[model samples]
Target: MLSEQPYPVGTRVVVQGKRGPEVAKVRGEATVPEPQARYGAVLRAATPEDLTRWEDLHRQGEDLKWLLRARARERQLPVKLVAVEFTLDESLVTVSYSAEDRIELSSLIGELRKHTRARVNFAAIGPREQAQMIGTLGACGRENCSSTHLQDFAPVSIRMARDQQLPLNPEKLSGPCGRLLCCLQFEHTQYVDLLKDLPRKNAKVCHEGSGACGKVTKLHPLSGTVDVHTDQGMLLGIPASELKRLPDAPAPKPKRDQPEA
Candidate 1:
């Protein structure tokens, strides 16, 4: 008697429909009804013969993948069908494929259904899911993140690029998913927090000369000197208080036309 599901004594049971030789198990008639409903009644204890048949079916499903590939080639289809999975009862079969567009798979599905005598389902997955199903190496030469252990995907944004001080080049930052890499957002909070303590780049520091203020060239937080350049292009180090914030500079005036000599 199975503890989860109540099965009548001498009833036939199938496990995953592929485990062969139906095993027979004896159960008392007084088993709880809810557990039986949830786990399903064991039809019978699986026999050794049933186990062998299940293993054979599993192998046949594996071999069917190559057959499907050959069929795709014969049909001249530009799709890569990666996985063929069958339900436990062998009543349904799902084929997973990846292609650039919505492929016309009605004929392929019809052929599979006709040959296998099982309900066929065609799943057109995106590149990420295809990579997951096929299990491939990524651009980094590492096992794909999706197939391994990344259960949750975080949203990667342009703010992450700005915070990480990375360039805004899509080719450099995008991942196998064709979106910004998840790793870029990891330390963004720390960078943003650190940036809050820094002064603006265009801030002007006080210069030593009377009535002549130098424009800020660079900032030195540790040295407390703001590097400044004068109108004549002389570079000087000025203390923080001596540095006065410079107003936004006006745009340059257009040159007047020269009189003909």
Candidate 2:
């Protein structure tokens, strides 16, 4: 709602008037920064009375949510309620539900309208989206990036795990979405860049001080370490920076005249 006086940033205001009275935080000037003003108007600043009413409405909204769920149970709705949001004006309540299969909520909505006499908005969301809306920790023991600050999700794949040299185990790679963890893609480019300078696994590499050639068995990019199978039949973890990649040994020629014997 537009205010006659500029409320500045962090100003709280009530919108939608009495029937609506939607509460919102002001980020900055309401309208687009232009000569002609075109923006929604704020009824007035959020007074102590408005704050009190907002609290009461929130409490009532929570109660109403339980009541709605109870009604759903009575009617046997298949959807599970993940979250409920009440408009400040109390004109509408939005309920988010998740289900494995298609949910026909037409009958449920009809019953809710008759019971509450208020607008009820229903939103069907995926399991990952539900977790995001409610906020959850990932298997990494940290707040989920999607719920915290990630604006969008990119397509994650098993190839991302292989690029990072991580095990292909599902439990280790899975996220709250039951798909591959999104963070696997975060530092993937850096790992790929590092791989360009590292010798291929199982290829011959020369140790600087030992004057011995060894096959690279593994790579540890973070610590710049490589596990080498040495000519002396020893497995050693050597710093990649101290080793030189060697030209591959020529393939042995196939034996001939074996059929004559």
Candidate 3:
């Protein structure tokens, strides 16, 4: 949301939310232009009344969360209630939860509707979303990226770890959500670009310095170094630019099967 008057980061402002005007904190200036439809103009700096309303809405949401949790537990549904959010206008209440399996929420939703006049919505979120809502610290001793700044969850895969030559250890590779770390995707493209000019491990190559043929033992894409196990029984770390790939030896023609005697 833009304002004619510049508000520094962390400034509180009012903007139109899906339900109504909402109080939001400015994080940073928008560097890239986006479709105007994706944004709304900042109405004004938050007023005393706006701050009061915001606090009241937060308290109301917390109260609603407890009610939702109690009902879910009474029904013995396997769900972990994550958050209860009330739209600024008090026209809607969104209930977020995480569950392993599909849940029959009709009974729970029915009871929740009795307590609130607003439209109630039940949102089933995944493990990652759950972690984000909880705002927990990750193994890195810092807040989870998804909770702090990530706007969307990008597709993450084990191949990202492999491309970066990370050890294939699940515990070490997983984030607070127990899924593959979202950060694995961050540097994967860079690693792939670096690897494009490097030889694959175990590939036959000739080292220019020793004039000896060797098999690649390790690749250091970042440092542009290749570890080679030379036929001369020396393991040498040489710059990738100093080595050239050797073509695979042609396979010997299979001996003709002997005729049955």
C-alpha RMSD by candidate, in order: 12.8, 7.6, 3.6
Candidate scoring better on lDDT of 1 and 2? 2
Model 2 segments beyond 4 Å from truth? 1-61, 87-92, 111-121, 139-142, 246-261
lDDT of 3 by residue, 93-150 (tens): 8889888899877777776677778888888889889888788888889999887656
Better of 1 and 2 by TM-score: 2
Please give the CA lDDT of all the candidate structures: 0.63, 0.74, 0.82
User: TM-scores of the models, in the given order?
Assistant: 0.49, 0.64, 0.86
lDDT of 2: 0.74
Please list the residue runs of candidate 3 whose C-alpha ends up more than 4 Å from where it truly belongs after superposition: 1-5, 15-22, 30-44, 250-261
Tell me how far the alpha carbon of residue 5 in candidate 3 is from the true structure, in angstroms, after superposition: 5.6
**Candidate 3: what lDDT?**
0.82
Ranking by TM-score: 3, 2, 1
Q: Per-residue alpha-carbon lDDT of model 2 for 162-183, expressed as tens digits?
A: 7678988999998877867879
By TM-score, the better pick of 1 and 3 is 3
Candidate 2 similarity to native, TM-score: 0.64
